[model samples]
Target: MVRNTLQMIAAGCGVLFVAGGAIASPAEVTVANAERRLEAGADISMTRWHVDAELILVLEKEASRKVTAYLQSRGRLRVVDVSVSINMDDRVILADFGPGFLPGPDEAEVFLHELAVTLRHYAEQAGLPIVGVDFRYQGKPLKSYYPAELAVPPRARIDARNQTALVSASHGLVRVHPALNWDYQRPDAFGFREDMITPPYGDALQRLLEERSGSGVNRARNRSQDPHPESNRPWDYMSSRYHLKTLLPDRTDIWNSLPNDTDADREVKEDIRARPLYANHLGVGTMISLHTNGHELGAIRGVEVYYHGDKPDDRPLAESVLCGMRELIRAQPGYENFPARQDASPGGHGENRIGTMPSVLVEIAYHSNAEDSVALQDPVFREASMKGVEKGVRLFREGKTCEPFVLQQIPDISLAAGTSQEITLPFAGHPQFPVTMEFTTANCSSPGACRPSKTTFDDPNTPITVLMRCRGSLTGDARWSVVLRDVDGVATAPVEFQHTCSKPGGSPAA
Candidate 1:
């Protein structure tokens, strides 16, 4: 089954062309990474930083205990600004920030997904690795924030688990090596020795896969062994506390199980499209929908990156993932970046059709990878993945690039031929933001069309209400749904709602 996967060059520097590796002029120490110099320096204040676009080009949003290490340790690599995104939870991604010249000025711009995609192609062609950050705010541009010296967020904390290392901060970004964990539910135990550094998840997976292939996916034939033996590592405070597990499989299974003709995917798709994060902001455009990619059976091994082919703008972002994966695979000393996509197939259509949508579905590694089992069983991956998820969110939300909270609580479902009841959904955003709510319905025919009978903004989280109005004449209740897009149009994950058409009041034809 030609699916959405791609392959390329042998182990080379992955997408993140950090110094010390092949990518040429390695990233030398810079003022940003100079701790003592920075500490003794003068007062540096942030000017402005905001994200107004859907995509942003950045090196990555890996974190450190102190801003000094983040920008300085790497040298010459002053964090012009890492492209990040924020959801209900703050998260960021290194790749979302991708390989780019990096941001400068009072700020870096996070364009809406549409605009970024349209223009990113030119940037990618020039051998650029910069990808886009997903911003959730309602079209907010990251304004310049400061004296690069002063404005940087406090140094982030760098920790390791099950041979996995993660640099993170409380509401900032965390760039972690993929060995951390492909599945959020799992986390490795016993951090990797300092000698073991995989570029990111892509690299880590390749390493583990290799050990297994050379030996076998099990305890009997393996050669490499866990260095840190902390079997009872405490629950990751952040992940466990927030329940930041990957999206439950039950949900995806249900989604895939539905017949294409079902109203479910249609309503949700409309909701997803209806709220293209930056659709409203003249400055903002489209977003590269980033999610914890996996398979219906949770059996796939590589990251399941999905991108919308319908949209030409997504070309660069799509290409970056495909190519970057290969680079990362080669960069990691150990590990193997396996491939299994429709595009990789001999008769495959090509790169154009890899994702379910323009979005990239990156299932970093199989939660089931044998090498990762010890780590995964250790449970470090959850915190590591959570850091990644948060980094992905933060890469788009940090600084002025922050998008107003996107309220995507829309739902699609069918109703009985003639019934009308009550329904509810979510309102994603900070409680303080002055959020406006609205809903509408379409595509009805036959005996009776179902509509929102009544809705109440009971809680602030999900706040769009619509009263369904029936007109057509069908048999059972007509199909209907609810949507709560942000002013910018970026929507939230969708849920389903169905109402009957047999109302107490005679088939009201409003």
Candidate 2:
């Protein structure tokens, strides 16, 4: 049987009181809230309220008690604190449980399933139409549960006729994230995984992948390299027996018409055709395509921004992107050979020719070059390239360019009380270029919560480590912000760290 008595501590406005009484049944609690909403002509199916952290804690405590009661009726099990977050806009209930809340993985699955059902039942009884329940264990996402009725419909059944109806929307730029090769069946293309290319660069342009099709197509089969081994040689196999197969596809030679005979070429052509129609519908003024260059000779390196010769307007945007890339390439330690160039050819590739808006194809770097390939794999290098592209796009849009060297790193720090820890901050600009960064703490529970070894980063690639020492009495969380600046005190974007100091001899809060 469920417990009847309950104790609620009420503390607010400098007053504290303990109220002991019989707990109201779930049905009674539900009816009260429902009736109140109905009397006010409010939607009884949804509840929206702004709650502070203290109020959330109270709700969590109440939820834990009811959940524990329900579980205990079936079997004896220990219950711990539960964290709850309600998103009224999304109609989601996110619950996180304390560590070791479940006996094992198997039991965790079963317990969570039951917990979701129980919570949904109580929420429905309380007249709240929660669309889903997302549960986490020890701060890691565990599982998400949603009613069958709330599930999204599958895309396969949707009719294709209506897809192009919304293509006429206007946009400032229709960007395309391109793949390296057209061989969708194989992963060996140097240009494969170019889809991952969007974030770092798109973030720079102040645009998003959703704004345009980077590859100009959705299907993996549309943008591939020639299966003919000679046309699409792997970087590692370029100097080996792979050379015996055939000669590479020759689109660079001015005399040859751009190849569009292969199945892959036809597929790409059709895909490219659709982009212009979509761009016109959307009223986008310009287009940008992203790609990585490749050559049989690894000696060739650097970036090339290609624009359709017929489209004079594309020159300025291409030049801006090239200038940004030049700065980024020069900043890299051993990448001084990566010069930035612009190609404005009349008979450019199909991608450059198809867009109604002014368009440019940016070859970030040659993947065949060993050094370039290594840089391509580095997250910091990728971020720099993206930032450069972003600066160029900004210059084109606003008639001004602000290229600020960025310092990017993880934003959270945690240490045990009376202990010290060091954090390394990574920068995404020139390593040798001196940058001054100032770190300051805020919302510290006690004095002397954190200390910085140095306030400036003068060396390139040398990570700055901050020594954070927590007082023995310090607990809970604090924060620190680092501002990157030039020697003249010009500040760029500021990165922050969430400082967490654990209670003495206790684990820190998640």
Candidate 3:
């Protein structure tokens, strides 16, 4: 391997000569091997170096390591093809991802974003001068880029004088003339539709936003409420005092229709475009479109938040919302292990894309799944979700990102003696890869009985698999923990896992 370094700091940049071979496999491109060669006193900005096919291959593998691993685990999603290119003098790197790349999910954005970050980081580590990065799918440039779009911190229109918010339930009343509601429905399996569920959620969200902003405001608004007589009608009732601009089409806005009376799908399409327009008309700087997700696969259940993929400003709001929702939803008694499926991703929903300001659409829980359907009906769950939305909006305004990596709750395992099972521990994060992870086992029957695939690896983007073996008919429960430390040496709270070893033919624990 050639370790190229730039000695000509005052001269022009060095370019990479194309050298070709088979593309490096992902396993061969672990972060542990991407070591920086610069001296301790070296300046990162001044450093520049050459690149080649080998370097580009490794960079592409590492850049895609996270999303690829995640999709592989789920048994879905694929990257048709990908290639990386760099402009050293301009300090810009562009990655062209072929078809099946975006796939209309927010994880695609995260994947592209993470890939861009990793590409730049690897190049910088290789002593190359890189300042910005972008990604393209099928030859067309993506709307956002790293470092540049993120330069402006996201601040919602929350002023001390009169703060305002836009909380829209995904589907509302289409009962009136020329109106339409085309929400994802499963009327046979589930009683209430997405339309039925989201309105109350919007109401709760509006109330929570008011309560969180200031309960005193609610008290002062009682006088205003008296005159208005709080009916199912459109007015600036919330904006008048509570400063919450909630759009619950289910209740207040029933007569929402275009003069060109049309079918359900067209009406709904127009409605999707109209909501954000209404928000823009009111000068609302932020929007959260609440919704319940459904899938043909009823097993798919979890929180899924989304933002406009093209609009870089939208992601912080989505991520903050996911973090907040995860924080509270996981705290629920029976819902501790619920996943934030792909966390937040760009779903190309018009609700998010049509908005001018920072906007996010949250598929809070899946309505098609039995477990999630029950959760949507639970008041405790709804309250936690609403509170989380409020917190997310607040956090976004404060420019707070989520914890870089969070290990999802790993369930206890039961195995027959003399048997081994490989358990993949999934995670969610605002990923910045090339970080280190360390695992510690406690109360193991023997040293090699329980082992991680990699004890000390330098990546947290993918799931970690732990091999558990019940050596010599060992019968007992054991515990293990993980200490995730980033490059800066900041460690998160240790996450623990429990597993039980049962005798060969005996029944496992209940």
lDDT of each: 0.28, 0.47, 0.57
Worst 10 residues of 3 by lDDT: 215-224
Q: Write the per-residue lDDT of candidate 2 for residues 1-510, one digit (tens) a residue.
A: 111111121112111111132333333443234435443456533443332354345447655775576457647676767888766565456788775354321123324433553443334334343444666666764322322312222212222122211111111111122433334211233553443433234343333222321322121011123343433433221211121112222312211222333332332233333434333434355556665655443555666676654455566767777766666555555555454442222223334454555556676776666777667777666656655664465455545542435678666767777788877766654322366667767555555645543377666557666676676666777777786654423344667768787866577643
Candidate 3 lDDT, 48-71, residue by residue in tens: 435555557665655455556656
RMSD of each: 25.3, 26.2, 17.9
By lDDT, the better pick of 1 and 3 is 3
Q: Of 1 and 2, which scores higher on lDDT?
A: 2
Comparing 2 and 3 on lDDT, the stronger one: 3
- In TM-score terms, candidate 1 sits at 0.21
Off by over 4 Å in 1: 1-286, 296-299, 337-359, 368-510
Local accuracy of candidate 1 as per-residue lDDT tens digits, 383-434: 3332332333222222222122344544543344344334444454332223
TM-score of every prediction relative to native: 0.21, 0.34, 0.44
List runs of model 2 lying over 4 Å from the truth.
1-264, 332-338, 342-347, 401-510
